[model samples]
Target: MYENLDDAELLRAALDAMNREHNADAVSLLKILVDRNPVHPYGHYLLAAEHMQLGMVDRAEEGFARAVALAPDFPIARFQLGQLYLVKGDGALAKSTLAPLADLPSGTALASYAKGLIAMVDDDVSGAVEALQTGLACEQEILPLAGDMQRLLANLMAPTEDGAFPAGVETTMSAAPLYLSAYGKTDP
Candidate 1:
């Protein structure tokens, strides 16, 4: 069915399949592409992600390693590789890969997110909430993801004492519900 599609289109189809929870189908499609183009970093990356979603950690790690080998500087692949290591409880490797990303301005929010994941793994709930919230603040374009994260953090870090709002923060928060309503989505 994907014979006429270009590589990027094939990748999009695989992502759509993954989003719809058809992980086996996504893997099959990605495997076809990877078999034909072994060095295609995106093919490896997509397969790696599918394997990760399916909880096949060993296969996921192998696929991610191949992606990194094929495209050493591919930021998304590197980020996911770090995440795989984090999931495997390989803190040393995760830190080694993710720490350098923090110094790059474009990678700042992602690096912060990785830190939050690490904190959660370490059972430091407060640190996770703080780090993820900071990351969400720094990357407002990630509204859907950040909104869910903000709700989770708010619940986790509910204030114990009454506090004054920063100048426009309350106004911004109050307006958010209106904006979300206008967009026909519930705030998470």
Candidate 2:
């Protein structure tokens, strides 16, 4: 039923399905889109995001990597890919994947998020919290991503079993998975 649709139409349908939480349908449509237009970075990104929502980490990682490879300037794809790596406990790879985002303006959401993630990797909980707060302040486009940052910040700030705030990366890493299922729905 979707074969006849153009790339734009297919993306629209996929987005609609995602909006309605019909991930299977969205994945089907996005797969067709990427199949028809193999170099479309957005298609791969969306497909990867749906994969993430469904907990298909490997496929999501591959799709996000493909999207970033195809469009190096696509900050959202790069950020999400790095985030996936961080959640998977690959700090080095995550830092590398998120490195390019540093070129973005310091006040931008992606830049701040990248800084936060990198700080988390470096075990700087205070720095991560500061950067995430900055990101949240300027983040209006991708609400879901902001929500993820907020959750991470909350986790970092929360006291441990001994009533002391987490002093290392453990809390951040532990809370990372909770935000994985919350993919950004905005078109990048």
Candidate 3:
């Protein structure tokens, strides 16, 4: 049934599947799409992201690297690759990988976050704070919740030199449900 759909439709379906947490189906659909069009950058990017979500780091890296190679001007792929490198403790590669993100519009949250990461890497806490504040200020219109943004700003500035963000930062981030409940947010 899917074979009859065009590339765009197939991609949409794959993205929907991925968003719905059907990684295996997303991978299957994306594999077919990529097999049909080897140079499709978005296809490779989505496939790589799905693999990453599935804990297939090696394949995810390969897909993300290929996506970056195919679309040199794309910043999101580069950001993902750079972050992956950072997670893997390849700071040098992460720095070089994220260098291009600076060329993106400074007002964008994406660019600001990338700059903040780089500043942190360079041990410039103040610079990171300033850039992040600027980014958040610039992107306020799209900020999901005003309270969340305020919390983020406060937590961001409260980090000790040795810690990443504040004490509750990682917890709220990676464990959103627990964080929300702990903060008495689960009323229903």
Candidate 4:
């Protein structure tokens, strides 16, 4: 746990461990950090992330909640909490939690994607397209959502009800090529 280190060093070590996927070591260090400095919002957030990586949803949610309580203006914590609500299928809660992301987050791309997902879940097709397009324009690196948005847009724009994409639809991607990997599980 690097007991000899100060708070900042401990946090760095915890984050380093987390980035390396050593969640157990990160959790141990973060537990000590939060224990020593209960008011440390980032400490709580890091702890929450480690907990999430360990598949401990309740603890992760609790830690995230604590971080929010400690620092209400932290957009990342709010975004994460909203994602958690969405994953839990609490659409109303997720919407309310994510309402601020339309303007407040450091980058709005993820927020827009989330908004698009919420709109799609709510059957607001036009709203979904608007949000997805806005998000893609803001950051092309957000390509994981492109496939979903493309499918949805195709459905909405299809002349027929056959569930097929329109002919001559732009096949070229403006975003970088994407890997076939799962998202919305860890970072969304």
lDDT of 1: 0.62
> What lDDT tens digits, residue by residue, belong to model 3 across residues 60-132?
7898899899998866678777766766667688788888886687677767767765775675657767766
List the candidate 1 regions with Cα displacement exceeding 4 Å.
1-6, 115-130, 140-188
List the candidates ranked by lDDT, beginning with the highest: 2, 3, 4, 1
C-alpha TM-score for every candidate: 0.64, 0.88, 0.76, 0.69
Stretches of candidate 4 off by over 4 Å are 105-107, 139-188
Error of 4 at 63 (Å): 1.1
Question: Which one wins by lDDT: 3 or 4?
Answer: 3
Task: Find the 10 residues in a row with the least total lDDT in model 3.
Answer: 179-188
lDDT of 2 by residue, 4-109 (tens): 8999989888988988888899999999999999999999988988888787889989999999999999888899899889888899999999999967987798
Top candidate when judged by TM-score against the true structure: 2
lDDT score of model 4?
A: 0.64
**Predicted structure with the largest lDDT when compared to the true one:** 2
Candidate 1 accuracy as TM-score: 0.64
Instruction: Say which prediction, candidate 2 or candidate 3, comes out ahead on TM-score.
Output: 2
The RMSD (Cα, Å) of candidate 1 is 9.8
